[model samples]
Target: MNISRRALCGAAVLAATDLLSFHVLATPSAPKIRVGILKFGTVNWELDTIKHHKFDLANGIDVEIVYFAGEDASNVAMLAGDLDIIVSDWLWVSRQRSQGADLTLAPYSTAVGAIMVKDDASIRAIPDLAGKKIGVTGGSLDKSWLLIQGLARRDHKMDLTRESEIVFGAPPLLSEKAVSGELDAVLNFWHFCARLEANGFRRLVGADDAAKALGASGPVSALGYVFHDKWANENPNVTMGFLQASGAAKKLLAQSDAEWQRLAPIVRAEGRELEVLRDRYRQGIPDRPIAEEEKDAAKLYAILAELGGEKLVGGAPQMAPGTFWALKT
Candidate 1:
């Protein structure tokens, strides 16, 4: 992560491709790495940064990004050899590995939600959320909400869904409803929560706190870079080079507001909106994969397992020791 700025900036920054540029060449002896990404997910920001800064070319990895409409489609494409790496959760990676689909995970991006409420709302703690209408996206099984549930049960002996009046809706609708006083509070996504924060919504609790209470070592990263282990073993240089480039991009974005401004138009954000995005994003940037040696990692796994049951996380009793890919190891 402490790599030279030149490695991140790359020599080809002068010839950096346009944001919409997708042209990539594959030599007879060197096949380009096919990276799959959701069109609007956080992964897009990182991939776009790599492309706009020419980091891929500088690292000698001929990269071609394949866009998918959603995670399900992206999973299909990865299995069909249409993608070498994809943005996904460690849970999915573990599930795939259990099904004999050799895969590995590396920390890439992390974002956590917040319980946003009116500035003067009386929702001071998790217990206050009880009996109040709360808007939630991703339904009852969203990872953040699940972590909150786990934390509540473990620390406060309260069942959120049973105690609170829960409403499920799209994120934009949830935000609007919360703003208009139609909903008492909104357990919204990080970006949306950031917007709400900028608009003066008070946070009752943060998903990061839930993650901590559930025993994560640091910021809980629900998302990561997943890649085929076979391909990586066969092309170690490309793998490490790609990760190095990614780390540099993370560093640059975390440290420079100018970098956020550069990509603002792409994200359709500016001013306070852009600042929130930048702040929330930098706050969740993960430094490494979870290690079993760490107590928090094991505790988090237990919490997720208890909350999600075997079905949600592919029935893994514990996070596989091989789930993480260490850049140095």
Candidate 2:
């Protein structure tokens, strides 16, 4: 999941030609933007396209993409001024904001996490998870905490810290551990979860199921586009243009199966069918901007604060007023 910034930038240059054809050449007349993304999995359809310079050609803006191995690396790159934009989880953004990292939400990207058990495990529900060893990566930006929070809200305050033994490891290793029964449950993002179930592991809970259990309508955070505040301030026009182009891509992703198929191979090079990822994408992922992105971001901040992560700005991370970019009506 961790990638070098230099390698990602190289990938972006190659992707630009494949994605934008004639447009990338025209975009150099304008200022270029450099973006960083965390390489989390194989089916990074959105980020893959953006990283490859496909978006630059399509939007006529020269974009440079850098890949980090993990969100923490991407954050470090952003803090060190190596990247202008970062596409990461809301938790990373919230944690960064708490520590005084000036960043802005661009748009929501994904909406679900998968909770899986081994194929032979008798666990059928969240409550059945009592005393089981669960594997999750532990850190300030721990995504498992979000899943635990959702589970607690749904299953009558199940204390994850006490009820389940948590084993910390990187995501791929965690998935491997879960499959081998070294861990009873593992919480993961899209493709890993899908692969677990496809390989016969039982799904105890997913983002959508947890949302329904909590009587909520969506996942814990609206995953989406993010940018550094300083970068946006310095390159307002280019940033706005990037947002517009990203918004267009989001819309295009919704309307065109052909677009998905074309991009899927770039994302899943091992001949993984687009339909596998497409099903998960359609379930709860939001392609357009949402009024609740900031609200959900605030909620995530609150959860992190409760879990003793870090303090937000003004002692409480209030959603910055007018954070989202609205396309002209």
Alpha-carbon RMSD, candidate 2: 7.7
| All models, RMSD in angstroms | 5.7, 7.7
Poorly placed runs, candidate 1 (over 4 Å)? 1-31, 288-295, 326-329
Cand. 2 TM to true fold: 0.74
Total backbone collisions, model 2: 9
lDDT for 304 (candidate 2): 48
Residue pair clashes in candidate 2: 1-69, 2-69, 3-68, 3-69, 15-52, 16-52, 16-53, 109-223, 109-224
TM-scores of the models, in the order given: 0.86, 0.74
Candidate 2 lDDT over 1-329, as tens digits, reads: 43332332223211222323335434447567777765644325655555454664565566666767776787777778877776665555655565577765655455566678877789887777779998765432455456455557556668766788877777779889887778989887666676676666767776556544434445544454677766666665676556555544544455567767788546552334355565655553452225454555555455445555343233544444434433221
Worst 10 residues of 1 by lDDT: 5-14
Tens digits of per-residue lDDT for model 1 on 97-130? 7777887776665677888999988888888888
lDDT of 2: 0.58
TM-score of model 1 vs. true structure: 0.86
- Evaluate residue 200 in candidate 2 and report its C-alpha lDDT on the 0 to 100 scale: 65
